[model samples]
Target: MNRKTFLKTSALASAGILSRPFITYANASKYRVALIGCGWWGTNILREAVASGVVEVVALCDVHEAQIDTCAKELNTWCTDKPKKFKDFRDCIKNAKPDLVINATPDHWHALIAIHALNNGCHVFLEKPIAHTLKEGTAIQKAARANNRICIVDFHRRYSPHNVSGMEFLKSGKVGRIQEVRAFVNYSGNGGKQKPSEPKPADMDWDMYCGPAKLIDYHSGIHPRAWRRQREFANGTLGDWAPHWFDQILWWTEEKAPKKIFSTSTKKIHDNIQTVPENQLVTYEFEDFICFWEHSINNTRPVQQGENVGAYFHGTEGTFHMGWHGGWTFYPHGKNATTIHEDPQLDLPDGQNIKLVWADFLNSIKTGELPHADIEHGRQATNMSLLGMLSNDLGRSIIWDHEKDMVTGDAEANKLLTRDYRGEWVYPS
Candidate 1:
C-alpha cells in the first residue's frame, strides 16, 4: 500500500478495527535473530528483543570485542543460550543466518548493515536517524522494497501510549490549525573539550568501526557514546534527537518533507574541539506551516520549563507541548483558560516503549505487512534533519525539490547529499 493508504489503515487500526488480516502462528518456532553494533542503545534494543521471548539471538557482532563480550554477558542473564560472537557483520550474517537482524549501529554504519541484511533476506529492526546521509537512507529504503523484507525503524514514540492519545487529541480539532511548531532539545551540559589522541584499544577494530566514514586518529572520547558529538561519525544533537520529534511532526501532519530549510549554529561552548555546533537553530518551511528546531548545550533550563527535549505545537485555539519524559500539556489561548495535563504511563523501563515496536515488527514479519514505523518514514525523518545540517554546513538556506530529492539552485549543497566513502567501502547506489 502507498503511504496515504497505509496511514488511513493505521488510523482505522488505532480506532478499533484493523484493515489488513493479522496472522499469528501458534506453536511456531522462535525466530533466529542477530544483533549488530552492541553499543549502549543497541544493547537496550537487544534487551527488549530478548524480553519478548519470541526470538533467539543467534549471533552478536561489533567492531569492539569488549562491547560484544559485555553484551554477551548481559544476554546470559536473560537467556540460556550464549550467542556466537563475530567482529564482522558479514560473518555473523553468513554463519548464523538469522531470520531477523537488529541493526543498532552508529549513524554512519546504518545504511550498509541494514542494506546487507535486507539483501540477505533478513527482516531488519533499524535504529532511527536511519542513515548518516540522505542518499544512503534512500538506498536502504530501496533495498527493503527490492527484497520485500519487513524493515521497521526504531521510532519508539509511535508506540508510546500517551503519544498515541496525544495524536488522537490533536486530531480532535481542539487545538485548531497548527500554523507553527517548535522542536527543541536544551541541556545544561556542553560537549567537553576534545581529549588528546590516544592509542587504539586492543579490543577495538578501529578501522572497521570507522567503516565508510574517514578513519581519524583514535581518541577515548570518540568511542562508545561520544560519537554522537563528532561530525565525521554522527550529527550531534540535531541528528541524535531531532529525528524523533521531526518524525512526530511528519506523522501528525502527513507531510513528506519541507520545501525549504535554513540553519545557523555556534560552537562557542567547546574549544572548537567538536565539529558539530554547541548551539544551533534550524528552520524548515513546509507548504502549510513552519518548524523551528533548536539545540543549546549551555542552557540552564528548557524553553517550556519542564520540557527539556520536546516539541510545542502552536494552533489557532491553543498550544500543545509534548515532553520527552513528562506527559503532554495543552494550554488555551485565553489568559484565564485552564491548562490540561496528563501524567505519562511509565510501564516500561526508561519509557522506551520499544517492546510494543518489537511486537509490531514481529507481526509485520508474520503477515508481510508494512510496519507502522517503516523504513520509508525513517528516511523522511532522517532527511529532514540532514537537510537542516546541510543548510548549516553550506551557511545558506536551501530550496529543496522533494520530488527530485535534491537541493535546488545550489550545486555545492546538492553535492553534499551523499558523502564520499572511505577506502574500499562503496557508497550504496
Candidate 2:
C-alpha cells in the first residue's frame, strides 16, 4: 500500500474502527518476541504486543523472580504457550532468539540491554527516556544504525490522535510564529520523609537489578514503582516525564537540540523517600525561541487553571495548551478572538497509545521504514532532559554542541556525560 493508505489503515486499526486485526501475514509464522524487565509498564507494552495478534512471546526476563512469575501467569491467560523465564537478559536473548525485544528496564539498564539486543539482530522496543545518560543514549542510537536494526522508543504521545491534530494545527500557522514553549507537571502525594531501607527480598536478585548502576541498599520506596525518584537508579521526575513533553516540542519545532540550557532544582521535602529534586525549573534556549520545563512533587495546583501536566506553546498570534488527558486548547491574541478547544479521546488505563505505537513498530519492521519515534529522535529527546539535569547539578547554565554531542567548555559538566558503571557491567561505547 501507499504511504497515505498505510497511515490511514494504521490509524483506523488503532482506533478500533477496522473490523480486522492491524497486521495479517500470509504465512503462519509470527514474530518471536522477548520481554526484559517485567515491571508494571514493561508488562503493559507486552500486553499490547500480545493483543496485536502478530507476535508470540517466547521469553520473559527480569532480575526479580516474582516479577517473572507474575508476568508468566498473565501471559498464560493471554497466550496459548508458556514463555521461558530467565534472570539474565543475555540468556533470554540467546536462548529465545526473539525477532523483537521489548526493553522496559529502568533508565540505568536501558543502554546496556538495548545495545546488546540490537547487536544480536533483534528489533528493540525501548522505553523512554532512551538511557540514563547522554552518552548512553547516543550509544544506543549508534548500535541501532551500525547493526541496521529497527529500534522504536516508547514515546507514545507521538502516536496520540489529538496530539497529531495539534501538530497539524501548529504547522498550519494558526498559532502563528511561536516565541516560547512551556512544559510542566504539578501534582500531589509525594514527599514527606524517607522510608527506611529494608533487607533485600529473596525473590529479587538485587545485584543483577543494580547492574551498571551503583548498588544501593534495597528500599521498598525505590523499587517496584518508585525508582523514578531515586537518582542512582533513574533520573527522577524531569527525566521520567520531560522526555514526552520535550519530544512534543521537538516534533512541533522540528529542532534537534537546544543551544543552551540552564536549570535550578530544590529538594523541599528533605526526605529519603526521593534523592532527586522535588521542584525543578529548566530553561532551554533555541535560535528563535525558548522552552521551559517546571515540575513539582506536592503542588496540586494546575500550571494554567485546568491543565495539570502538559505543554504550552506561546506564539505571536496565540497560545496553545497541549494537555495529556485533558485535551488541547488554543487562545488567540486579539481581545475578542474566540478560543478553540478539543476534547481528548482518552486512552483509558493510560498507556493505551502503546497499541498505536506497537502497530507503527510492526509496520516499520515489515516495510523496512523508520518507526515513528526512531532511536535518533529518542536520543535527541533524552539528551534534552539529561542536559537539564546536568545543569541543575552544576548549578549553572551550559552550552551544548549538538553535532559533537558534548557540553561546550565545561570540563566538569562534560565528565558527567557518561558515568562509571558498577563492577563488570561496562558502559556502552
Candidate 3:
C-alpha cells in the first residue's frame, strides 16, 4: 500500500507518527557529503547518497588503498567524474571540507572519526553501534551537541515503513500493553580462524586500519567480515546486529535503558578467535516489561517471523512480529494472524529503509531538523548490547542506574564501559 492509504488505515492513524519531526532552524540548497570507509556497506552508502539528489560526494576515505580505489572506479562507471580518495580520515575531512561525513568504518573508529568531523563543523551520518564502548558513544553524542551539528546514526530499521507501522499500531493500544519482547539472530558462522600473521598488503595501511585500537598482527581471516568477531575491533554479533533489532523494539515501545540485564554465552566455535559469543542468551528487565535476545551462529532455528532474524512483541491482546526485511504481522490472541501493509514503494532499488534513512538525514541537514534515527536512539541501542556483553563477561546480572549511566556498585564491571585508545588516538576532553 502507499503511504497515505497505509496511514489512513493504520491503527496509529489517530495516535500520530512513530517519529516526531525536529524543528528546523536553518536552510540550505544542497549538502556536500564525504564518505569514510569504502567497504561493501560504505560503497552502497556512496551510491545511495548520490542517488538521494540532496548531496554531492566529494571524498571517499578508507585505510585500504585497494578498497578505496575500487570504490572510486565503481563510481566512475556511472558518473562522469569520481570523488577524490584518501587513506587518512583526517585528510578527507580537511581537504574535502564536506558539510557531512558518511562514516561506515568499523565500530572502534566511529567515535574518533565522528568527533573529528564534528570538530571540523560537519554533520555526520554514523553507522550503527555508535562506538566500540559506551563512554565513546556518549562522547560522540556530546560532540554533536557541543558543535550544534546534526548526527544521524544509521539504525536503518527505524526507517522501515512496515516497522514504523507496527510501532504505530502498538502505540494505538490495539494489542493492549506490551509485556515482553523477544529478538533473535540465527546465522551460519562467517568463517573459522585466520591465516596467521603476515606482512601487511602493499595496498593497505595496517596501522591506519587499527586506528584507536591496539595494532595486532595482520591476518587475512580478520578482514572483509571476520572483524565483527574481534573484541578490540567490533562488538561481535551482538554489537553488529543487535543495534538494528534492539533499536526497533526500543523505538516501538518508546523505552530506554533497561533496569537490569543478565546474559550467558559460550564460544563453541572458533575458540581461537578473539571475537565474541558463538551462542548467547540475554534477558533485560524494564519497570513493567521484559526483553529476551538470543543468537547462535551455528543454528538455523525456526523463528517467530519465519525470517532468520526478527523480533516478536507479546502483549495482552496478541503478539506482533516484525521482520528485518521490512514487513509486520499481528497475531491476535484468539483470532487469525493478519498482515499489515506499509509503503509499497519501500522495496524500490533506492527506496529501501537504508535509503530512506539517508533521505531523512539529508532532510534534517537542509531543514536543521533531527533525523528519525537520532544519535540518542543509537546510543540506547548500543548501550543495551554492550550491557549484554558485560553481563556475559561477568557471568552475572548487572543492575543499571540509568540516571547516572553506569553499572551500580561494581567497579570492575563499570571499568569495562570504556576502552583505553592506543597510539595517537585519544578521547576528546
RMSD to truth, every model: 4.6, 2.5, 5.8
**Superposition-based RMSD of candidate 1 using all C-alpha atoms, in angstroms:** 4.6
Residue 167 of model 1 has an lDDT of: 77
- Per-residue lDDT, model 1, residue 173, is 93
Candidate 1 local accuracy as lDDT? Answer: 0.85
Best by TM-score: 2
Stretches of candidate 3 off by over 4 Å are: 1-29, 271-274, 303-305, 335-352
Return the TM-score for each candidate structure: 0.92, 0.95, 0.89
lDDT ranking, best first: 2, 1, 3
Predicted candidate 1 versus true structure: per-residue lDDT over 1-429, tens digit per residue? 444544454443344311212223212438989999898888888876776657778899999999999998888776665689999999999999999999998899999999999999999999989999989998999999999999999998876767777877887899999989999888866556656788998989999999889988887777887888888989988999999999989989977999999999974656635678888999999999999999988874634556788889999999998876788889889989999888775434466767667777887887788988999889999999999999999898999998888888888998999999999899997
For all candidates in order, the CA lDDT equals 0.85, 0.86, 0.78
> What tens-digit string does per-residue lDDT give for candidate 3 at 1-429?
244433333333223332323212113316777889988888777666665545666789998988888888777653444468899999999998899899999888999999999989999999988988888998888999899898998876665657766777878898788889998888976466545677788889988899889988887777766788888898788998888899987876656889999999975656455567888899999887899998988878854345778788888988777775546777777656565444332533444456666766766676676667889889899999999999998999999987788999999999888878887788654
Off by over 4 Å in 2: 1-6, 17-29
**What TM-score would candidate 2 get against the native?**
0.95
The candidates, ranked best first by TM-score, are 2, 1, 3
Q: Evaluate residue 404 in candidate 3 and report its C-alpha lDDT on the 0 to 100 scale.
A: 88
Candidate 2 per-residue lDDT, tens place, 1-429, comes to 344744685577566622223333313437999999998888889878887787878899999999998888877766665679999999999999999999999989999999999999999999999999999999999999999899999888887778878878888899989989999988766644676778988989998898888888898887898888889888888999999999999989867899999999875666566878888999999988999999987676654565788999999889999887777889889899999988776454663478778888888888888887899889999899999999999999999999999998989999999999999888889
